[model samples]
Target: MTSFLEKWSARKSDKPKAGMRSAVDAFRVRVAEQKAYLAEFESDGAGFNKWRSTWFQRAPGGFGVTIGRDSIDAGQGLSYVVVETTAQVAEFLDDLAQHADNDVSFQKALEQNRLRRAALLNSAKAKVKAPAAKAATRKPATVKATETSQVSGEASVEKPKRGRKPKA
Candidate 1:
């Protein structure tokens, strides 16, 4: 029979990953025109901040975020990304650029941004070693006996009592 401890361990392992981090080069995209994610990052996916546009709720309140990593310091084409939590990723893909629909755009932007990151990661998997799934183990089943013979020469069994209506 499967032990409680084994079941507990399996459940624990099934919990969402906690150490994922992602990184990716930053790029600019118009929120109104962006069809994919501006960035992507799952704290425990492949690597932290790996995708130029993505979101991760590192802080409290589980507020999702879109990410933008840029080398704006050197101005060598200014590498950076913009992030929005919730479904507002696409709206905020590039902060510097102007978009009138900040509120809605922000929400949509966040979602699109996440999707973009996911696509990139999928592509990366095709090129690299996609992580392997953890294997789960099950214990052997136990046999269930239905009948027994008594030492006194009688079938030592009692029939279950019935006909009790539950009170409302």
Candidate 2:
């Protein structure tokens, strides 16, 4: 007797149902549109540049969540999303969207991520500036006794006494 899997496969149509096919097509189109929208920012232009810089000023990695095509892989599933952000932030957002039970939790996670990123950036900036600060505050080296010498009326040098001198 044929296995249940084999019977099911035999009964299934090779082609998707008409409604399903249309839905898939629509999804594909939407994904394409989303990708196009994102690509617009990648180019150099005044409007896009301004938006990229300012859009997520309050968020980490310059990202905010919306319901849209997958930012990493546009042709796949849909969920809460982030765009124009670093890969790490995108992954964090994706995980947050998946596991968060409600809006409150999601907002909390987003805020935490933003604060964490700001701290990291501030730390990095501090590290970069620390060496410069140290250099600026450094004092000039003092002249050593050996470096001084008398060479006429213009300059004088005090030579250290050689050998042991009798105590007088």
Candidate 3:
């Protein structure tokens, strides 16, 4: 038998099926359109450059937020963070702390943040109802076993058989 690597290598030279090629091309087009839309959105004053703050500032205290490559100080009550060098990260954390101290919204957001341990525990546990218990609670299926016996010309009861009946 050909190894997986060998098979894969052999298949690599062959062109994808027409349907698959069209699907991939369609996906690429969609991705490009999305990228363009995002670019235009960002370029506008209401976009990422402005922290999308205008959209959020519909209320007196409302604010929009956007994360930067270097920092997590998005204007909203939340931010996405990226860790780089240790010193830079330390400095960023210090700045974030200072910002949080001064910003009531950020402080509130931080207050609402779930602890890592609690989040992990919550994620690890699934809350699915037991199917077996539900099945046990259901009424047992009633069997219709009565059939006319051709030989005796009388009705007889037998457990219903599953699947196709054998032809005599």
Candidate 4:
């Protein structure tokens, strides 16, 4: 079979390390485990598209993430990573293992933040209600009268008595 890298992928500066091909299988192993975990949580797609996505950039044998067209509106974006050396790939595997733990921590943090926001909102609501509640609980104030309400038929009575004076 073709080597892990060939043609354009062959690094001009770093000759494909003597042992790279053999150790490259390790990349597959790490990728495999990631796929297995993804398999359990999968909700769509078939084959690798169903599980954790795997893409190869031949010139570099690098991998990275991109949002699949189908999931765009759902806001489910993709995360990509590539390992150029065996060390990087090893670190990637280790990171994958730690990712499980990280995922748990992330969830816990999200839940905590949600609870905190809820509590703050409740507190604000209580503060908003407090003044109105106190107003309701207190006795109503008596009205102080300054001006009297106008009666409907009240009219002026001082019409000039037209005593006709002597015609000028």
Candidate 5:
């Protein structure tokens, strides 16, 4: 069976599929627009000074925001994505842009992002010798029977319990 790290590495090695880049870029543009909208009112004193457009708290006690045309409390049609506050917009956009409605695609996108930084370091030694070294260093799996006999150097036999014998 594959080890946990092996499985994770395999998943991380997958490149983001077509359109992934565009989707991420589009999401960024939308976020920028929302920020600009809030910025437009930043200098206004017409009862806008107390507004917390990017805060995540509920209204009255706090100011929540609706996305585009969405209601503050509910998600609307495809054009709008409602959120408790504007601060949550990026997270919602991440899921939306990655098409994370399904868990698998979401995981793939997530893995792709997780390893993005590692992809850039391209050191010469790692590129030339790492694979060969890794192959040479890997040890063969040990047999379960051999493992069981390691302490006593005996054949594979179940050892009796070591504590005081139970009453007959």
Candidate 6:
């Protein structure tokens, strides 16, 4: 007969609980469904933006995926899954379709997702580092004062007029 402690230890060695496994499986299924929808949209030559908007939500200037809590950090206390951008989804699909083995496909998807995220972060950083447009410089106009009429052969003092002359 097996002891209770031994049985508990055996269960603990399993790493992922049944609930966690189910959550991950559900996430995979959702990804597949999204991929199928995207394929249909592509075959019909429809605009991706419209389909994307319908499927995903915008998050911090990019798109996001909503997965179960177990799928993110191995059944952590986080309320929601980490957001995945549109590019990350595309890369994952590309990897999933290209690879034959499940493990290989998952590895490829992770690598591609990381690369896409790095590229996006770098682009954002570059935009932040870029200098702002310089404003155009204008030279001040020069005004010459001329004596219109001489008063008793003495130079008449004239004040420089500002702004446009009034219409007659």
Give each model a TM-score.
Answer: 0.22, 0.29, 0.26, 0.27, 0.25, 0.26
Return the top candidate by TM-score: 2
Better of 3 and 6 by lDDT: 6
Least accurate 10 contiguous residues by lDDT in model 3: 53-62
Writing each residue's lDDT as its tens digit, candidate 6 over 41-91 gives 556644545554234445675655443212222123322333455557566
Model 3 clash number: 0
Which regions of candidate 1 fall more than 4 Å away from where they truly are? 1-67, 70-102, 130-168
So what's the TM-score on candidate 1?
0.22
Error of 6 at 143 (Å): 22
lDDT (CA) per prediction: 0.40, 0.47, 0.42, 0.44, 0.48, 0.48
Candidate 5, after superposition: displacement of residue 87 in Å? 9.2
> What would the per-residue lDDT of candidate 5 be over residues 55-93, giving only the tens digit for each residue?
222356334444332222112233443465444654554
Off by over 4 Å in 5: 1-21, 45-58, 66-168
Indicate the residue-level lDDT of 136 in model 5. Answer: 72
- Which window of ten consecutive residues has the lowest lDDT sum in model 6? 67-76
Better of 1 and 4 by TM-score: 4
Arranged by TM-score, best first: 2, 4, 3, 6, 5, 1
Better of 1 and 6 by TM-score: 6
Lowest lDDT sum, 10 consecutive residues, model 5, at 68-77
lDDT of 2 by residue, 1-168 (tens): 989998898678777666443323343444444444445644543456434322222255456644332222221343444455644334543443344424454345444544676688999999999999997777644433334422332342355446787899
Consecutive 10-residue window with the lowest summed lDDT within model 2: 67-76
How many clashes (backbone N, Cα, C below 3 Å) per candidate? 46, 4, 0, 2, 0, 0
Model 6, residue 142: C-alpha shift (Å) = 20
lDDT of 3 by residue, 102-157 (tens): 76665444333324434666765533345666867886654222222342333223
Q: Between candidates 1 and 2, which one is better according to lDDT?
A: 2
